[model samples]
Target: MLKYGVTHRLSTTYHPQTSGQVEVSNRGLKRILERTVGENRASWSDKLDDALWAFRTAFKTPIGCTPYKLVYGKACHLPIELEHKAYWALKHCNYDLKTAGDHRKVQLNELNELRDQAYENSLIYKEKTKRLHDSKIKNSVFNIGDRVLLFNSRLKIFSGKLKTCWTGPFTIAQVFPYGIVELSSTNGPNFKVNGHRLKQYFGGDIPPMVVPDLQTFPMDQ
Candidate 1:
């Protein structure tokens, strides 16, 4: 990528299945593609450039600059402006070589400041998003020896609605960071599951559960 002056960045693994910004970008692109091609979805590939141009030039309030400007360090000249000369375009067209060179240098010098301002705006945007997300999250707190319910969606296909949707009254064997807990079932296997899926078991007499034999579930799942 460095050969062509491109930078490649991997997505954060914090919660890869639910990446907010990427999903938003994909949704916006899909909307653009739908509007550009209408019912002729097969022609979307042909109109890809037009769709990209629209996205690049569109003002994004989060950073207060078009994507095109951020990448090229200057505002984009639309096709119409180039062909039929807007007022600003007309004025620029009359500039001498030295004047244009000086203007270009000045713009390049200002690019750093523009990028810094955009970076600050992005940090603020992320903090607001984090707060909004955290506000909706009711964190599940579990302690060792406490009984809790385990969500049984995987077993539901065979059992149907008549059967229990939750399987546990399982004892908490261990607690981990990021809302994960180790569970043990009486005379059965021990496993780890997300705290979101487990609720405190408050119904009846708790059974003695053992966890010497561990059955680890996929962390990504």
Candidate 2:
């Protein structure tokens, strides 16, 4: 990648949001493979090419175009187009070597514009998605000296079903902007954690209940 001047980004462990696009693509590919392989699970490798072609040719809402079209500056010719002698198929079939070369050059020249438009469309789509997500998020408010429970996300893998994942009645030592919180525990040092991981801890002493003495009349004994 360095040889090609491409920059590489590493995502943090357990944080899928850092690489959301790659995660979504993997999920889509898994679904496509599942549908294509059906009961022939062992033949998934054989159907890989078909699955890839389908994915590349399918329209993406974010980009507002097929992946193949964005990369090649033209839509892919479907098998049906060849079988039915579509206009695109016939136009390319009649082109001589020089004519085909010139046509390809024209497409390559327009490739940059196509990519720019796709980029803009993707930005708009992401903005709308972020807005929708933000609309449903209820902002958590925390104050200094308040008690809160810290969620132990790391315990998810090996913990038993009945085990509680929340680990703390930590005191909120400081509240920072952008969902950052500093917490202090009784036996541990103060530390900063994401505010989302903390929830208001309502732990306190419960009042003792008093029962009045009951007087019984002489029984039938």
Top candidate when judged by lDDT against the true structure: 2
For candidate 1, the 10 contiguous residues with the lowest summed lDDT are 9-18
* Prediction 2 TM-score vs. true: 0.67
lDDT score for residue 195 of model 1: 72
lDDT of 2 at 178: 59
Summarize candidate 2's per-residue lDDT along 1-221 as a digit string, tens digits: 97999976543344455465787788888899998896869999998898888999999988889999899988788779889989977766645889878888898999999999999998897788778866976788999999999877663456687978888899999877656788998898998877767788998898899899999899898
TM-score against native, each model = 0.63, 0.67
Candidate 1 Cα lDDT to native? 0.78
Deviation from native of the Cα of residue 167 in model 1, angstroms: 9.0
Instruction: Report the backbone clash tally of model 1.
Output: 0
- Computed on alpha carbons, the lDDT of every model, listed in order, comes to 0.78, 0.82
Error of 1 at 118 (Å): 0.3
Cα-based lDDT at residue 20, candidate 1: 70
Residue-level error in angstroms, candidate 2, position 94: 4.7
